[model samples]
Target: MAGKRRKVPHALHSELSEYSSLLRALSTNDTLDVAKRLTESKPRKRKKRTEEESDGAAENEGTAAPSKKRRKRTEDAPVDAESTQNEAAGSSQLPEEEPNGDKPKRVRKRDGWTRWPLLVTDLRVPEFGLDEEIEALVRHCLRNNNPHPTDEDGDSDPEDDAPAWLPHLTQSSSAFLSSLFALLAHHTPARPQVMQDRLNAIDWRMVLDILATCGSVDADVINTVKTRMEAIYGPYDGPAPTRLEARAVAKSRTDAALDEADDAMFVAVRPSKRLPKRVLEDVDSDALDD
Candidate 1:
C-alpha cells in the first residue's frame, strides 16, 4: 500500500514552479500558499520493492551483465584505484536507520516567504464592538478634544478647534474607525448608511484609504480587506457631502426636524447665544423680517 502511493512528481513540481514565477508578478496574496505547496520539489523516497518486482529485477540484472569482450576491455583499462574504492564503498553503503530501526523523519525545507501570513476567515467583527472600541481609542488618543464642543462654546473650545473626527461630524474621534463601523452597519439588521457630512467630504472610505490618510498604513500595501468583505457581501459598492451642497441636504433635514418638533408639545426653544459673525448676520436679518 505504501509502495502504491506515488510521491509528488518532478514534472508537476516544475510546472507549478513556472506558474509561481508568473504569480509572483501579480499583486494579490491570495493564491501564494497553493503555489508554494504545488512547487515543493521534495526528494522522493525510495519505494519498497515487492517480492515479485525484486525477483524480476534480479533476473534482468543477471541477463544485463556486461559481455566478456566488454569486461576484458574494461579490465585492460587502468582504473584509478582511489576512485574505484570510493565508488565501491558508496554503492555498498546501507540506508540510515535509527537505533530502534525507524527511518529518519523527513524535514520539509521551504522558502522563507512560503512560511505564511495565511489567515483567511469569514468571522465578522461585531458592529457594537468596532464602534465602541475605535471610539474609545480615539477618545484615549485625543489631548484637546475631551469634554466635547457643543453648538455653544464654554470659555473656549477644548484647546482643539473641533471635537468631531471629520471636520464637524457625528461620533468617533478617528475617521478611520468611524468609516469601518459605517461599512459594517450596511450588513446588519440596522442597515443604516455611513452617516457623515462635512467640509470637502468625499465618501470613498476603504480601510486602507482612511489608514493612508492618517499615515498609519503605507500607500504601497494595497487593500485586501475589500477582497474578503466583497466575497461575503456580494458587491461592497454602496454609500458623501459639501457645505453649499451640504446646506441643501441640511436644510431639508433641519426643516423636517422643525416640523416634527412643531407637532409635539414644546418644551423650550431659544436662540443660541454663541452664534458666529456669519450666523449673527443671518440671525439679525431673520429678526428684522420677524
Candidate 2:
C-alpha cells in the first residue's frame, strides 16, 4: 500500500533539481528519465485555511463589518511587493533540460611512428614481384668467398692492365643491395658467426656502385646504405676504379674466355688449304701480326 501511494511535498521541485545536480556530478546519464518522471508525478499541494483566519472569523461572528475584518487581516499579514514580483518572474522561467542519451567522449593519446605490421598468416613473399636481376645480385653477394690474406680482388688488382668488367647497376640492384645489407646488419633469423667473414669478403666498391646507380633514392637512405656498407667492408681511403679501368678489365676477361678452348664450347676448324711457306716465313708473319 505504501509503494502504491505517492505524497507531494512543498519543496519537491527544488529536491528534484538537487538530485539532477548530484546525478550529473556522478556521470549517471541513464537515470535522468526516471528523475523526470518522479518530478512530473509529485502530488500538488491543496490550499488550506490558516488557524488565525478561522479564529478571527469566529470572533467577529458577523458583529464587525466585512470591510473592517478585511482591513484587520491585511494589516496582520503584510506582503512585500518586490518579493511577489520576483516570485512571478522566477515561476515564468522554464527549467533547463539535460541531454540524457548522449555518452561521454573518450580522450585518445597522440599517435607516433609505427612499424610495418607483419602477421604470421601473411604471405611469405613480397606483395610486389621482385626483379630477377636483383635476386641474382643478392645471391651472388650472399655466396661465401674463400678468405685471402691480401686484398687481391678485382678492386685491388693494380698490375692488371685491363679494365674491370663491373655489372651495370639498376634500380632493382640498389634495392636488393639495401635489403641484403639490412638483413646482414639485423642478423635476421639468427646471428651466425659466418656473417662477419662473409661481410669482410664483400668488396666496398660494389656497394658504392649500387649507390651511384640509384638516381631516385633519398640522400639519407644513400648515406645509411654507405654507412652499412662500410660497417661490413670496413673504412678505406682507396676508391673504386674508373670507367676506363673497368673497360680494360672487361677486355682481359673476354680474351681469357677466348683463350680457353674447352670452356669456349667451339670446335676448332682447321684450314683446308695449306700455305706452302718456309718455317722462317711463318715466324716472321706471326710476329708481324702480333
Candidate 3:
C-alpha cells in the first residue's frame, strides 16, 4: 500500500531537488566571500605592556615573586645609571684639563740696563772721596781743548766752581744707559741667542753711532765719547728700550744738565731797581716816626 501512494508525488520531488541545488550554490558563494575577506584583512595584534603596567601586573602576582623580579630589575638599572654619571662627569672636566695642556706659557724679557746689574753695583762708588775726581772728569769733558788745572788758586779758579758728587752723576749715566739699552732691545726682534751675541759684540763703533745719532756729539767727537761711555757702562744682554725707559733717560739727562747749570758761575745783583725811592722813603719815614 505505501509504494502505490508515492507514485503520485514526482513533480514535487523534482521541484524540491531544484530548490536544494540553488540553496547549495548560495551557501558556496557566501563561504568564498568569507575566505576572500580573511585573506585581505590585517591580523588583530596584542599591544605590548609598558614597564610600569608590567610591574604592576607582576606586583599583583604573589608578593614573593614580585619582590624578586623588582630586585633583579633594580640591579640591572644601576649599571646604566653609573655609566651615565661617568659620561656627564667626564664631559664636565674635559674643558678644564684642555686649557692647562694646550695653552702656551708667556715669558717677559728683562729690561735693557737692568741686565747690567753687576756693572751698576760696581759703579755705585762711595760718595765722599770721589767728588774731586768727578769734578775733574766733568771739567775735562767740558773744557774742550783746555787743560783742567788742579789747584783752586789757578787763573780759572772760579772759587765757586766746585765738583759735586760723582755717584749722582754715575747714577744718572747708568739710568740713561739702561733706558737706551731698553729702547734698542725692545725695538729689535731677534732670537735671545742672537741678541746676546750682538750685544756682546757692541764696541766703540756702536757707541760712536749712538753718540752721533742720539747723543749731543759731532761725528769727529764720537770716538772719544764712545771710549768714555764704554768706560762707564760695560757690555749687557737684555731686552730693548721701552717708552718708560726712554722717558727716564731723558729726565736723567735734563736733571744732570740742570745740576751742571746750577753749579756753573752766575752773577747775583742786589736788586738794582729796588722798590722806588718814594716807596722806600715813605717806609723809612714811617719807621722813624714810630
Candidate 4:
C-alpha cells in the first residue's frame, strides 16, 4: 500500500535526485552525518580531574608498582603548577589572542594590492624629499629645451641622436614621476574641461616611449601617471597625436618653468606685472546738475 501511494512528480523526482547527487558529492557519501561532513570537528573540552579522583588513581597506581618514575612525577607536580602560574602572569601583560573557535569561511578572492604608484597632490622637495636625479630632470624640462620635447621619428629615432642629457635625466622612479605629474596637474592654467581635452589628445604610447628612455621605468609607473591625469583632468579618448603634440598641450597649460626654492615655495619668473593705469574723470556731479 505504501509503495502504491502516488509517486513524486517526475520534475520533483529529478530535482530530488540532483540534490541527492550534490549532497553525496559534497559529503563524500556521508550524507546522513551532515554535521560531520560539512563542519570541522572542534576539539572537545578536557574534563578536569577532581583531587579525590587523582588520589584514587595514584593509590591504584602505587598499589600496582612504586616505580621511581611515578615518585618523580608526583614530586614535580608542584613545580609544574608554579611554572604554569609564572607563565600565566607573564602572558597577562601581553595582548589577548583573537578568538578562533569558529573556522573562517574559505573564500577565493582576487588580489587587491595595487601595483600603481599612490596618488599625490604635490611634490615639494621639503615634504617629499629632494632627489638629485629628480632635480636634474626638473631642470632639464624647464631649461632651454623645447616646451614639448619630442622627436618626430618617435621611438624609431636613434638613441644616440636623442639629447645626451635626455637619457641621463632621472624621472623613471614611479613615486617621483607620479608626484611630479600631480604637481603639474594641480598647477595647470586651463580649466578642468580644457585640461581633459588636451590630455585626450596626447599620444600615450609615445609618452611611454619617452619615459622609457629615461630609464627602465615600469609600465605601472606610466599607468599611474596616466591614471592621475585622467582622474583630475577627465578621461581623454580622442585620437592619439604625436608625443610632441601631447607635451606641447601640457606645457602650454602648466607653468613648470618657475624654480622652486628649498622651502618648497615656487619662485615665479615675475612676481607681479604692472598694468597701464586708466585716467579718471575729474568732473563733479554738482556742475552737471547746474
Number of the top candidate by TM-score? Answer: 3
lDDT of 3 by residue, 69-132 (tens): 7588768776577776886798688753221232234559743321211222223343564445
For each candidate, give its TM-score against the true structure. 0.18, 0.16, 0.21, 0.15
RMSD of each: 24.4, 33.9, 47.7, 31.9
Clashing pairs in 3: 182-240, 182-241, 183-241, 185-240, 186-240
Q: lDDT scores for all predictions?
A: 0.48, 0.49, 0.52, 0.50
Clashes of each: 0, 7, 5, 0
lDDT of 2 by residue, 118-198 (tens): 223321444554455554554455334433424455355333422243233445476766676664444322325644222
**Where in model 1 is the C-alpha error above 4 Å?**
1-82, 88-121, 124-131, 144-290
Model 4 local distance difference test score: 0.50
RMSD of 1: 24.4
Give one digit per residue, the lDDT tens place, for model 1 in 65-92: 5356447757898778887788679757
Write down the TM-score for model 3.
0.21
Between the candidate structures 1 and 4, which one is better when assessed by TM-score?
1
**2 or 3: which has the higher lDDT?**
3
Task: Give the runs in model 2 whose Cα sits over 4 Å from its true position.
Answer: 1-106, 110-118, 123-127, 132-168, 171-290
